[model samples]
Target: MKPLKTIIVMLLLLSISTYNCNAQDVKADVEKMHQLYIEMINNSNLENIDKLYTANASIRNSDATMINGLENIKNQYKATFDSGTFTISLETTDVSQLDDNHMFVSGTFVYSKTDEPKGVLKGEFVNTLKNVNGDWKILKSYRYLETTDNASIINSVYELFSKGDIPAVLALMDDEIVWNEAESNSLADGNPYIGPDAVLNGVFARIGERYKSFTLKDVKLHEMSNNQVLATLHYVLEMKNGKTYTIQAAHHWTLKDGKIVGFQQYADTKKLADSEKI
Candidate 1:
């Protein structure tokens, strides 16, 4: 005859096997639901959105901004669709059944506009699926969408300056700014200019006093993943000496909180020195 403890151990193993099997089934079901969601969004069919999402469903943007309720979600979706023809694909990567009433799901999504079918944007998302009325629906979604285009922000500064909007240009700089000039340049004396006022007085004022005119030409901005922007352009300067010269220059900019925090200049110094005198 088998011991009583042996029987209990056998039952426990059987129960665990059963629960694992159920978990696998749940994962499969969630993936299928996501496929249908992709179809609905791609087709712009929100007529039955209520059937898909809970009334209190909310989206948490990458920036921590929340879009609450079904109406807001619908409006955002409608706006995206109106923007252009787009197709989205989501591939389920992980699913965890937190409890009988809640499941956690995560996946990567790639969305491509019709005009450029290969792919336009790719991001990952984590979603909480809740059991409401015996139906699985997204309770909360956390996803990423880049709100700050660093290149565009820097480009706007140049555009504003070209229009003689120096105040607008100064507004883009943070309260405390660190500015540096290229070695061998006269402006390098104010290396590590501490504030916007310092930059305005030490750099802009000096340039305004010494030069007849100064502007950037053929400017192109390159972005780095680490919040740095590199702008390549020609420094079109009309020296008080009455000669106009264009020197290749590059500016390395660092930004935080949508404001410029640091700047480093690289330019042809010899040309600048020769032109300064005659």
Candidate 2:
């Protein structure tokens, strides 16, 4: 009985030690994977990228497109590298360990070329890592374009406005613009002012004609939960007829290809009408 008890004690200790060793191995593997990413980036090692990605790896973008297979992944990076000397900085976040073999990580990739003079190519990305046969591999990845956080589009528009750069401001508006003035009316003549020329000549120019100069004051951005942004602003306008009026407005804007494409304007229609009553 004493010998049997000794054997059981030995077995328990061995089991406990194995469990602890495995736990440490997992932590080490995570660190190793991160280091490998850094090494690959620093070397621009397009050749060894297959070692880091799975055979059937997939990359989905925030724009809702997917890239599949190792070749595609390699090609993607190759093109980017070929285009310019890519300087990429990666940050990992939301690293949730799904299991012993699966993990999810998300972060931003601040990309800049050694040649481009403008600001950096800023964006965010998310990745799913899976451990297969003792090696961690990127099973899936997703990337998205980063845009202005606090209605910077509107700010850009206002900058052009201050300069009285009408063409620059008009270029930001869509082909179809919603004036949002008529009561419950959605017609081109009523709610919307259709076509670029109509907006340029009819709306913006008319506003300009009324004002010798206008200055937007107290611009505020209100972002809705649905990703819609309202840029609320007030401005004082000195009329060509020597009249000054305070106008409050809301510019509802939507973005596409990093530019404003769809727009809705809400403001005091009476003030606009009163000024334009020729």
Candidate 3:
């Protein structure tokens, strides 16, 4: 009976030793495959992908749609690169080894375009690596695309305004406009300019009169909410008296139906008075 006990114990020990060895091998292989994947990406070699992926591998986009099969991945890549040239990079954050054969890798995908001032897209990604026949391969990969923040959109609106495209600037706002001013006369008159036409006539027309020519420079945009924006303007006003006055001002805006529904302006009254020589 004691001999039998010894044999059973030895078998269990052998099994544990084998498991650890296999786990170590898998870890090493996964690391090697990671480097190989990166090399393939840098080289832009799609042909070698078959060496790292199975015929039935799957990829899930940030939108949660699963694309299956090796050919599908190739097609997706082709379509994306064709639409716009891009260079993509990956950054791994958290990695969990599920077992000797499986792992979950969390990371980020950064994309850069050929265009100047290339916009950045930041998003999360997850990749599942599987060991098949002593080789590490990507079994499933997922990624999500990030959206631009409100500040960026508001800044873009100001850029459009600076170009003197009133229609283009107004197109970004809601139809029912609410315009306010800090001046005593405009405020005392209970003047809250509403709608597009009223805004163009009552408020925007007044702006033209204040300066022979006005240009916004070094403007800043802050998004108060998804539908509201506070645009801070640094403007140079060219006066009729052959002088230029610089003013810092802010405009609060609410948007509805892709148009400016509400607007409020704020500025230093003293500075404005000095500019107008009032």
Rank ordering of all candidates by lDDT, starting from the highest? 1, 3, 2
Off by over 4 Å in 2: 1-6, 42-44, 62-64, 82-134, 142-214, 218-220, 238-248, 255-278
Native-referenced Cα lDDT, model 3: 0.70
Encode model 3's per-residue lDDT on 1-278: one tens digit a residue: 57998999999999999988866766566557666666655556676688788778999876567899999988876676565555667676776789867888877777654441224456887889887887768899887776546566567677777787776665555446666777753432547766667766776677787778888877777777656888887778788887888888887866542345677778776676777773
Deviation of model 3 at 264, angstroms: 20
lDDT of 1 by residue, 161-238 (tens): 889888778878876888999999988998989888899899988888988999889999999877899999999999
lDDT of 2: 0.70
Candidate with better lDDT, 2 vs 3: 3
| Residue 195 in model 2: lDDT | 55
Candidate 2 local lDDT, 1-278, one digit each (tens): 57998999999999999978876666566557666766666567786687789999998865567889999988877886776665667776556678888888777777655654333557787788888897888999888878655366667778888888877776665445444443321212534556557667666665666568778888888765434568888868777778888877777777543445566777776775665543
Q: Which residue runs does candidate 1 get wrong by more than 4 Å? A: 62-64, 117-119, 145-228, 235-245, 248-278
RMSD of each: 11.0, 7.5, 10.5
Q: Alpha carbon lDDT of residue 11, candidate 3? A: 97
Candidate 3 to native Cα RMSD, angstroms: 10.5
| Selected candidate, larger TM-score, 1 vs 3 | 1
* TM-score against native, each model: 0.57, 0.53, 0.50
Q: What is the lDDT of residue 95 in candidate 1?
A: 92
Best by lDDT: 1
lDDT of each: 0.84, 0.70, 0.70
